[model samples]
Target: MRKNTFNIFSFDTTIRNPQRNIDFLQIIDKIDGKVLNEKSLLIYWYEAIGKGIYRPQNINAEIRNKLLKGESLSESEIKRIMQDNPQKVQNGFEGRAITHFKALHSQLLLIYDSQSKVVRISKLGRELLNHPYDVQNIYTKILLGIHFGSPIRKENNRARVFLNTIFVIDLLKREWGKLEKESKGILRHECVFVLGIKDCDYTKCVSEILTYREMYGLKENREYIENYCVSNDLKHLKYDTIKTYVDEVFRKFAMSGLIIARHNYYDFSSFESKKIEAILQHYKDYTFMEFSDIYEYIDFAYNITLPWIENNEVRKQIATQKAKELHISLQDLDFNDLTLLENKLNQTFYQQALKSKIEVSQIDTLLNELRILASGAQEKSSLDNIPEPLRLEYLLALILGKKYGSKNLESNLIYNENGEPLSYAPAGKADLLYENFSFEATMIKNRNQQLNSETTSVARHFYESKKQNTLEQRAMLIAPYIHWDVALFFKFCAKEFDSKLAPISISSFITLIEKSATFSEFSTNFDRLFVDKLLRDKTDAYVDSVNFVR
Candidate 1:
């Protein structure tokens, strides 16, 4: 028994390491006794041997003694025994050091190519040792197989990378699911309903791999064999055919993840997450060949297919409604129209404040000035621009200035080819900056609401030529919004230009409203009285505005 243990350990170690050592069939023959008889003992014995060989040789004397006594080893015992002498044997056993490197090499080849490895042994390999087969425990091993043994990439060959059979199987087992419990699984049905086979099979395979099952035996019927064949929907496929499908599925999944050939392990994991995200970001990323059938399957699994599938009556109704909205035939109303409608809707909301009697001419002027102020304020508010987070403060200043009036506020409007002020790249160019920014629009508005002429307007609008480079960087945009120390403010600019621009006091706001009879009346005067007043200050306050041109 001791000699047999040594031989089994030595043989398996050799077989596992090299590509051409142990004939896998021979190993199977040795272990395949009556399922419940000494063969079972043979299985356990081989298990012990396999465990002993790969395990670190650092066995503690106590645990070693315990294991030698034929006591069933606990996980801790196994671990301790392995750790004490943490090395695997290259050859010798019982002082007979075998130099049969070829035997080891052959064994590894069998392990790699054998059907048993794909079927029974791959599943049972974990049991051959005392190690627990959890996802994390085998993740490194699986990753190793993907990097070293996969057909995708050779050691350093620059070819299209292929995933190993194990990765292929895991991906399918985890990701694919049946369309419905009642719906039979068949290959032809997928090919038929899903539109094509190439991309669909891969998508289905991924879905299968990600799915969980309660019974291990389920693989025999649903996974390993196409036993769900009924009628002409699916004919039972040969092993090679199934293997081909599995291979294609894996290749497609890897391709979708951008796992080209010759990628290193670091490259594989480093970019895998982002690649997966890109694939999942849009439904369109999935190919019609791949997702068409799986779509039904997912719907069925979720119990949403009956209402959606068959003739897709619900879809038709949706299509009809969409067609009505576009005033076109159902066939003419494609997906792009929905996107166009969305853009139009957003634009409507943006124009909500524009629906005033404040003349179309005034609308353009107000919007241009607002854009200038808002853009500048946004740029200055960014931390990158001002070294702090004060976006709200800058925005508040712009908003209040526009609503009340500011003398310290200023702008250089950019005009387009048609001589219209452009919202984006203004026509020519203008660079304007406030020398003094001591304007409080809200305070001025409050004062002006009392209809007091005594409230001196100190608010000014300064203008200059547009800078060679606009504020494009996020840092530049984010800085001005942040809070800065008084010292930092002085360093950025002088204090002489920082005098208070008397914005409309709160009292003045009241007087302006009192002068208006309705919301419409208020809106009419708003652009001229408040917004225009603030905008005109751009010329009034800017000493540079008079001389600067595009």
Candidate 2:
């Protein structure tokens, strides 16, 4: 087995960059059963980023900084960087990309097939593929449940019954808060000596975590320890190595809504102590599933069934509502019930080939979600669990695909080998694909942000996408609100290139959706909105172009 080792000295940096976790899983899902070429993943990683679907953070620092400064690497030089160059195999893009991929594997978010020497997205990884809005809450529960002896991790045995060191911190925070009462929360420095050790004693983690605070008078901003003159800790525990993990865990704890991270201290959240007590009681009743093989374990961990990780009431409400709809009530369904999610809130919207699928029929159903999401009050709906932006992006793909005739429509969102959606639609590309038109959408609210970020990119992509087709083709940019000034900026692009491009507010787009049931009506209605209202009308029309969020 290719052991994914974890100890105090080693911490998964992937937790710090959760946006890219789905991005990573999207790529790994492609090469699930492929053999190792060492360079296979680097190729996929670079290609995805090159196409703009992957996060720019995937770029190696050496190349990213230079690219940001307007310098670029030659084609041959780029190829050379991808070759067999170093003993560590971590230079170039491989360094940043592989580090997170391996750590996520260790977290059981992925599965590495030992016999085949191939990596696959585990069940938990697929859960992330489905929902990412409250990712910190979901990840914390998974992190708390898994221990060294979990069936999936062979090398973590040295951790020896240490039930997720992060879980130990949860206990430490609760216990310390009781003793200190009105005092400040647990200090950062003490965690390195107490909870961060490789063999952290599960039974005594509380006492050890508490002992250091009492012994050293630890509190906020009092973490620096120096032998002579150094910001480093005096006893040489290499605080830098493990401190990021501590900070990240504390941050996740805060988001989990059980614990609160305040400045340099950790404490339980404002919710009554009963919430923490309930979590602990259920945690005690939890038992690790001991499957003989790795695949079975992956399937079990895929849908997080834990109920007490956060607000159990909220989870139960969501679960019950989901059950009521199907008329298939079950006695128990946790926070992330697959039945509630599965295809409902997929990160991607791509489906099987559009051939004879009559996908447009589904747009009626998707409009139900769009109505909730567009109102900016997702909390009251079934779509509440997903981020507003992702839900918007997914709905656009499905609704537009069905509306425009699925075969004629193409969505640029990132997907796996199966052509399913995986993450948010990336920039530098026309987000939605139609024959010859550069149609796109964004949930960005600020006027300046839209102008600075999308002005050139949208105009340029419109021109580029249209170059392969016709000048009669048009471009439309949709957002929650549009700035009059931003509308005028795109007008300049249209005038300069002798092309047709216009920006529309999401409210206007929603209006079109409500009015047009077919592609002909959808297309012609938007055409009138573009030309009749903004193109030939007085410039004052531009002022009202920016409307309230739909």
Candidate 3:
């Protein structure tokens, strides 16, 4: 019998900041075989965070004495801690279940050998580590793929609940059997107070949400939800925690372009709705796997169910949903073939690629998104309350990938479960690497900060990228507003080193649409004119590096 009988949905509260999760993954990935016990992980994590960074006077007497007396304290170690200034609060993090186990809760890492209690990063976790500059696609997939009983959650073994939650949300809002859903979308309040927490069955959850909708109406705020949470005492999460669950965990979930969370109501983005559609056939494959041993649990929970990992129950739901949509009998389609569902998804995505629009409207959308970020507006078409720096980094990756097909470039941003970019990179890598060229982007709008922080960082990235591939090497920096002096500083660096290190402003990036008829056309033209030209003449690389976009 499952200890956690009721399906209580939870995205780890600690995963609120995805960059922190990425940092945790990196520390672990560096370990031998990327494996370790939770106890060892805590000590390693504590040291890596430099948790005792406070000066000897500022530190508590006992802890400081223990360290100073037994260990030879070096001035360099203290200086390093002060210089790093780890700002993430570590109040009781040391004892909080390897609190950063947010990575495991997120499915980024997994308990590879459950018997030995060996924790290791997952395949997806390694991908995230490999690509720390951008994660929109990967993270978004993870968010949508998360289920009520996903083994990826904080407590996988004890829980026995089942639901393809994203599928459920889509079903609740999307038209079905030619009939509109009661709410037409999941309310923010519904997400916080109900959904996976109240019930594992999507149908039952829908009824529950509909009941709430009738009482609270279409628009309900956090206070209203908090009130209901206090009254019900469902699963006993604090009222404050309810707010964090909505604002942080769920906000990250919606950052995926697939989910439009504007107006405080979550629905499928009309354009990206096909993403849900593509996966619709696998909804029933989401189920809780019952395992007797470590190997069995890993095998079944991770693969056997995916009928999609341990992948079989969600396909049943998708088949039913498909039947309703087609207005056909359930007997009409072959729901039993798991391969059919996977193929259906693959077909939808292949169609998605062929459906790419080069129309002016495509650029119009990208440009508009950029403007919203630069103005620092709270309101937008879809994403909100997400970190602006991560958003900027994501947007730049998208823009560059658009200009030069993804096959040509790789980004270095890390993602959360929602597949949204959260951090730029680890210590020494550039934000983007494309055909021997490096591109770095920052959200720092202040000119002074750029001069202090970015000048040396940008130079370092350029040199690192160059060392990897010496051919036709160059680097580009992007920001909302590039300082003239900073641009000139790069120009001086260009003369001293490689001359192609340059910066471009967001304002200039906005004009990208006007300059190019289409993304492919822009890629072709740039490749032929600019990128190809440098290869012909070594002296051409000696030109000034400053783009002067202030």
TM-score of 1: 0.17
TM-score for each model = 0.17, 0.49, 0.51
Global Cα RMSD, each model: 27.9, 15.2, 11.5
lDDT of 2 by residue, 1-550 (tens): 2244334433365545444466567667767657545667555654444323332423466765433222335555455444533324446555555565666776667766545656667667776776664454456555554544456555443342323343565666567567755544456665554333335355465665566556555652334332211322222345465576566554433434445555576655433234445555555544444566666655555555555445556445544453453344465434465534423322222333222233424666777777665444323655443345555666776777766666667665543222323344334577776666666676655556568776777888877776777436778887765676777887777777777678876667777877888777777787776644666765557646535432
- In model 1, the worst 10-residue window by lDDT is 473-482
When 1 and 2 are scored with TM-score, the better candidate is 2
Give the alpha carbon lDDT tens digit for every residue of 401-491 in model 3.
5654555555565432233444554557676666666767776655565677778888987776666665756666667655656666676
Name the best candidate (by lDDT). 2
- Segments in model 2 whose C-alpha atoms lie over 4 Å from true places: 1-6, 38-43, 51-97, 113-115, 134-137, 149-180, 197-203, 219-237, 251-258, 271-275, 285-293, 296-300, 308-501, 504-550
Estimate the TM-score for candidate 2: 0.49
Best by TM-score: 3
Those runs of model 3 whose alpha carbons end farther than 4 Å from true positions after fitting are 1-8, 32-97, 102-119, 131-164, 174-184, 193-199, 221-233, 255-257, 293-439, 442-550
- Runs with alpha carbons beyond 4 Å of true place in candidate 1: 1-200, 206-210, 213-318, 321-529, 532-538, 542-550
The residue-level lDDT of candidate 3 at 6 comes to: 39
